[model samples]
Target: MAIRTTLDKDLDRLKDLLIEMVNLSKTAVEKSVQSLAHQNIEMAEQNIEEDQKINDIEEKINNLIIQLIAQQQPVASDLRTIIAGLKISNDIERIGDLAVNIAKSVIHIGAGPLIKPIVDIPRMADMALDMLNNVIKAYIEKDIELAITTAKADDEVDALYGKIIKELLELVPSKPDSFNQISQLSFVARNLERIADHTTNMSEHIIFMVKGKNVDLNA
Candidate 1:
């Protein structure tokens, strides 16, 4: 009984850390896009600098998971939970990197006046962040249905990314002078698309953790 109690406390700590990790990744993504749209260099720089915090949280979660496995020798559902925690942390860390990539593209845009109005990029970012939020919620709540639904919803972000790319391609011929801005905006959109993909990956991991079934939502 005492051992079970200690394990429960450790598992609870893992849950809290997972929440913190995903939330920071979401912040990185949001701040990255906002900086690009509003030309806030400070925010862009902060986005890059703060990504380390996400990494730290991921590390902390991983260490906890390892300790739990070694000490508790978790079986069945507990094993699944620890495995899913590892995968989720990895995906969230990648999402943080995507945020940094977006910030770098923003810095490349250099606070210059946008060649075109900012639209789809920010929209896509919001959608991706929402997906991330939903997956984390579903994971913590043990809601496999919500996890599956959120993973499937990545299609909207995918569609928006495609539309943005097509529009940017069109802009090149019509506005030859603004090619740099168009190209940079395309990079931002691409980063958001990848972030959405990572969120979907997290959702799949969550579903598997609960149901012990392997399914791909991206397919």
Candidate 2:
């Protein structure tokens, strides 16, 4: 009985840490994109600084998962949760890194006005952010549908990214003077798409945790 109680406390701590990781990543992605859209160099700098905090959370989650496995020796269902939680946390950490990448792009683009009025790139960021939020909810509620929804949302982000890239490629030919900003926007779009992919990976991990079967959410 004491062993079961101790395992429960450890798992509870794990869940709390996972939630902290989610919030940190989610806000990092949001603020980073906002910095890009508004040309907020100072906010971009802050976003870059905040990413270290998210990395710290990821380290804590990894350590806690290892501790739980060693002490609890969880079996089957419990074991799946611990292992799958590790995968999801890693994906979240990657998302935070992507956010940092976006901030870096803003730093690259400098303080000049965007080459074009922002449109699809912001749309893509919003969709990816939604995926992050929904995936977290699905994991916490053990809701398979919500997880699936998060995976499917990746398609929208991909489509927006494709559209942005195509348009930018065409623009570079005609707007030679603006080529630099257009190229930087392409980089930003690519980062957003990769963020969506990592968020989709999280949903796939959540499904594995609940169903005990691997899912190809990326396909």
Candidate 3:
């Protein structure tokens, strides 16, 4: 059957907008991490400034969503799709903000001495990025199994986060002077972990979009 309703088209547009937002967010995150790892202050500043672009995209998506709701009078899955778009856009915007937070942390740390090797934190970041990328793919392709697999990948991120925390704790006790710096690194890990959680949330939203079923990740 052909998609005959204006509502369907609007919903499709909403999904497209979300996919753009996800791509922008992914670029922002990758750049933010690269800036931090390389101690490129200029690149960090650029990432921080680019957050406004993400905000603008989010605002546009929101306006489109409101327009669809007021004009389309959609039912069933169309309604669910609109709701999912709103939720997913929110998640993506927060992901952008988290990237900005990491960038800011990089500036705060400055050209300081090495706080370990940053291996674990970057590894956690890679996993989080992979989760975000795959979840967005699942949304675009309507692949439920891929979404579930992305959700399952969150476990690895959580475990890496725990390990980072443990290692930081040990470092702090031994190197009392570096406690504050280590704590900041821990915050970076926490931000990345939260990003993974948001990606998982996106996966749940994808499940809702495809199956009309709500999934509780916490349960």
Candidate 4:
């Protein structure tokens, strides 16, 4: 009983750390879009610098998972949770890295007026953020349905990505002078689309953790 209690406490701590990681990554995504939209170089630079916090949290989670396995030798279900934690943390960290990528694009574009008004790119960011928010909730609740729903959200992001690319390509003929900014804007959209993909990966991990079955949610 004492051993079980200790393992439970450790699992709770792992969950808390995962939540912290999610929140930080989510903020990074939000700020990346905001900086691009408003041309806020300070926010973009700060978002790039703070990505380390998300990376640090993932490292902490990795250490804890290793300690739990070594010291406790958890049961199959607990082991599943721990393994899922490791994978999910990686996905979240990737999401943060993609956010940093978007921020970098913002920096590259500088304070110049965007070649076109920012519209679909922010919409893509919003959808990606929504997916991230829901997937974490699905993980906490162990709700497979929610996971499925969250994974489906990625399709909308992909569609928006396609639209943005098509529209940007169309602009290249007339807006020849603004090629650099146009390319950076497309890169930003691609980063947000990748963020949605990572969130879908997180949902897959959550389903595996709960069901002990490997299913592809990305399909």
lDDT of 1 by residue, 1-219 (tens): 998899889888988998998888888898998898899888898889999999999989988998998999988888888899899899999999999998988888897778778977888888888888888989989999999899888999989999999999998988898888888888889989999899898888998899898888989
How many residue pairs clash per model?
Answer: 0, 0, 0, 0
Error of 3 at 73 (Å): 0.5
* By TM-score: ranked, best first: 4, 1, 2, 3
lDDT of 4 by residue, 121-141 (tens): 988988999998899899899
Better of 2 and 4 by lDDT: 4
Candidates in order, TM-scores: namely 0.97, 0.96, 0.95, 0.98
Candidate 4, run of 10 with poorest lDDT: 112-121
Q: RMSD for each model, in Å, please?
A: 1.0, 1.1, 1.8, 0.7
Name model 1 segments beyond 4 Å from true. none
Model 3 segments beyond 4 Å from truth? 1-5
Residue-level lDDT of model 2, residues 3-40, one tens digit each, is 99998888778788888988998898889888888899
- lDDT-wise, the better of 1 and 2 is 1
* TM-score between candidate 1 and the true structure: 0.97
**lDDT for predicted candidate 1 compared with the true structure:** 0.89
Candidate 4 lDDT for residue 213: 91
- Model 1: residue 77 alpha-carbon error in angstroms: 0.2
Which tens-of-lDDT digit does each residue in 23-127 have in candidate 3?
889888888788778888899899999999889989999999889878776778888888888999999999999999988888887877877887888888889
Error of 3 at 94 (Å): 0.7
lDDT of 4: 0.93
